[model samples]
Target chain A: MNWDAIFTSLRLASLTSLILLVLSLPLAAWLAFSRWRWRFLIESVVALPLVLPPTVLGFYILTAMGSRSPLGRWYADLIGSPLPFTFEGLVFASVIYSLPFAVQPMASSFAAVDRNLVEVSWTLGISRLATFFRLILPSAKNGVVTALVLTFAHTIGEFGVVLMVGGNIEGVTRTVSIDIYDQVQDLNYAAASRTSLVLLLFSFIVLAVVYSLNRNSPLWPTLRKR
Target chain B: MADAEKTMTNGARPLQVSIKRNFAGRFLLDVSFNVGAGPGTVLVIFGPSGSGKTTVLRCLAGLESVDEGTIRFDGEAWSDTAGKVFVIPQKRNIGYVPQDYALFPHLSVRGNVEYGIPRARREAEGPWIDRLLLILGLTDLQQALPGSISGGQRQRVALARALARRPRLLLLDEPLSALDAPTRSVLRFELRRQLKQLDVPAVLVTHDWEDALGLGDQMIVLSGGRLLQSGSPLDILTKPENLAVASVVGVETVVPGRRVRRERGIAQVQVAGLNLWAADIDQPGDEVYVCIRAENVTLEIGSATKSSARNHLPGVLLGVVAAGPLMRVKVDVGFHVDALVTRQAVEDLDLKVGSPVGISIKATAIHLIPR
Candidate 1:
């Protein structure tokens, strides 16, 4: 069992979780409280990655970020680079793949906020945007935390999306989950065992934060802790 | 009633809610009323459930949008459908206290009160907030969360929070409904005093007759999504517009019949269950409603020992129902009438079902409504 791989996966998961947390808050607020009737449509679109296969996202995103596709060409032509095969590309894919774990919690939490409070805030002459930032977000602290931890851990466990798009670029796209798989494919039992241990431990801690905070997290703790 | 006074005031920013909502199939709510807010004034909307009292406040607060109506505050239009003017609640600067108080469980008592206050107003809000808490007797519980607090304390917190906004108008939707009797009494008195201090226009919605009489300076009786009557509480209770309004004002009897003739102040009406005379009348009709207060009727053993009361009828006691400290004796002569009697009087008479008794109602006590 390699402590180093476990630590690396833990760090990657934490970072991914942080990134997902920042993105889901506003999007969830819009979906939850918007007067717009068409929010359901936007909600369904965001939830697409939850139901669709990871490979589908990998296929679409990979094409869009590749040199041949128009967006890919423009990205490549403008910046002399593409997102595919890069660590940043993996982060983006992880965000897309684990979006439901982050956004849904936010949407439901925001919905549960006491609408009277919102109304009171408005009657106090506070703007809608201000109400969201101060009232809606503060009340939804628990939901935001859950989304963060789940997205982070979910991204850490990714295999299909990374494999399709992020070709094992060491120190870049070679996330700990992929490294463990590579070890297994080679039938190097010692290396595979080490990588597997690291992945397990990394997942354990991210999930630990999630459980300790809110037991209603997507994943539950199998073993009880005092 | 009185407890809600300090808790909710409608001052210069009176909640002048006017709404006209039309749904596709059957649901249609058209109601309009003004709630006076200022010290020593309470506007109580009395009605049964589903009478649109709650809807009135919701429309005013911008919680429920009206298809056609106007909600104005202090002569400035809060919402006027005809003028295409509507103001969002968050932008309206009014305090709305709902039935359940709806305090955030995660927030402390102080936190709950400080919720709608902006960053700039926060510092300035402390003294006033503390005063409200002290007035509500929730000073010690400031740091406690709503979940850990008692129902009465939670109510006080809601009141404090609403007051902390220093709102121009206060709208309370049955604030004390969930509270027990004892707590309600104490809070009611405390609220009355505070309402006087706020000097803001306030409206309190309740179905309880005692609540309306005790708390309201002006009472608005609503029924079937319509405003039946709105005026001084005494006027509303003393002179209701119709049977529905009479019921809201706690008038015990609504004799749905007609006036046959009128001579001087005594008007004869052939009520469905009995023959009674109203001392006041404008027109004689084939169909009219007669309202009688339960306490206005007096009962005696025989028809001889007459007093200042003008109308007397011989009846048999049908049943007696205990209402608070008094027992309401249901008597049937030709017409069944309810006479509220003291418990001690009930024991003296040994009041039981089928006991023969003479029921006498004063001439002035009989109020007639032309149908």
Candidate 2:
């Protein structure tokens, strides 16, 4: 309810979404266009975090960086400490936790762009890089927007990953989800209700805007007709 | 290497699509022929379905990759498998119009026409597009989308788009077969005039002889992926190299026969079913195939009495095949021989399948060659 908490949640959600877009881009593009026979393996891995319980993912991240594995030990030496109980670790865990919500819509949307349009653009002497930026990404705008809003909202409402990794460290790692949990644990029901309402309202507003814009889109129906 | 060298020697000038493609398990298309386009030169690639006419165009346009060949347009090697050189389609400076009229559906008539020019030249596309629109009678439809226009309009739009490219060569794949009769005729005339006025070479593909006769200055007939004959329309039509081309060039019937005797210019050949006389038989050869149109074999309904035509054979009316206004009457005189007769003749004779009739062939009507 306070201005600082609201700002913190907004910043955290924005940072989480930015990280998600960067991490999911190649995976999304690959899923959209790759013809390799073993593509299902990459697809299943991207999709695994979605169906797997958020607690399960958080628990794995906790163990993976708990000085047990060689990667964790090496990372610990580089940072002079282990990854668990850090804000960066929470962001890293949340990116995987929110990947399906970010990338599935993008891949499907990119897949729906007309191959003829792409081929013609290429044959028209347009460079491949221009074709990707001007044609592919713009044409797949709906997917990008869907990815952005879903990742942002999903990250804002995160509880399990942050809890398992950040261990409720205040200010640095206590996001809106952890804040609400702390409020409820202290019997501060009013503060918890306010945070929950804001998150619910934020998600509803983002989803409503995305859905409304999609209704007026010409590219989406053309894809459906095809 | 030998094929490429021979083709270069044959087509050393401008017609340089010297290629042979083997689409494994599908079919083989090895066509090596050359005829350039200028004010009075338009090459017609006439063939049956799946004869690789369109593939030839694509190879030249640098669209379909060839297994072995050199596609040189204006001395630039677009593709040379032996030389391992290739130029992409955009840089080739060719205007390709596909069979389906592959115009950008999203663009307006003017937009489609103005597609080929560089962005810097776009501002000056006005006069060009205007001239093309005026030529195609599409001045008013410039703002209209392709879907909202007629088939003839779409054809003109696609043609204008190709023409606006100002390429060295033009490629059209059955541009008129999709239109109605009247529109086809109108577009045919307009397209021929435009091609001539442009003074650039063209390769037009079609399965229809009418297109060849109406538009082509250099007509090439093809069948089953081989060049049957190539020459001017009249030259190819009247003197096809073999039976395969004679049939394609409107010679309706091909009868396998042997030359028997000759007197002056006229020669007699004993065929399996009938005797035929042909003029100008320089070398009718040991065995020959006489090609004749049914209309050339004139039909006369008689009382078994008066007729001066020596080639008359008694036969029963087989059936009637009427396409549009023209009628083709098939007659079976013991052997199956078609007699293309006028509708008026059918009426006058009261001709039907069981109707008894007679067929006559003038000596000049028979175009004969080796089988």
Second chain alone, TM-score for each candidate: 0.87, 0.89
**What TM-score would candidate 2 get against the native?**
0.78
Model 2: per-residue Cα lDDT over A94-135, one tens digit each: 777888888887888778777645544444555656656656
lDDT of 2 by residue, B279-320 (tens): 656763658877776667777777545655557778888789
C-alpha lDDT values of all predictions: 0.76, 0.76
Error of 2 at A88 (Å): 5.5
lDDT of 1 by residue, B13-113 (tens): 35566688876747678887655455546778888897888888777677878899788766688788899887878767777888888786667898888
Tens digit per residue, CA lDDT, model 1, A43-74:
89899988788888889989878878887787
For candidate 2, give the lDDT of residue A168.
Answer: 70
Off by over 4 Å in 2: A1-123, A131-223, B1-13, B221-225, B243-252, B263-265, B279-281, B294-299, B303-311, B321-328, B339-349, B360-365
Task: Pull out the clashing pairs in model 2.
Answer: B37-B201
The CAPRI class of candidate 2 is acceptable
Residue B297: error of model 1 in Å? Answer: 3.6
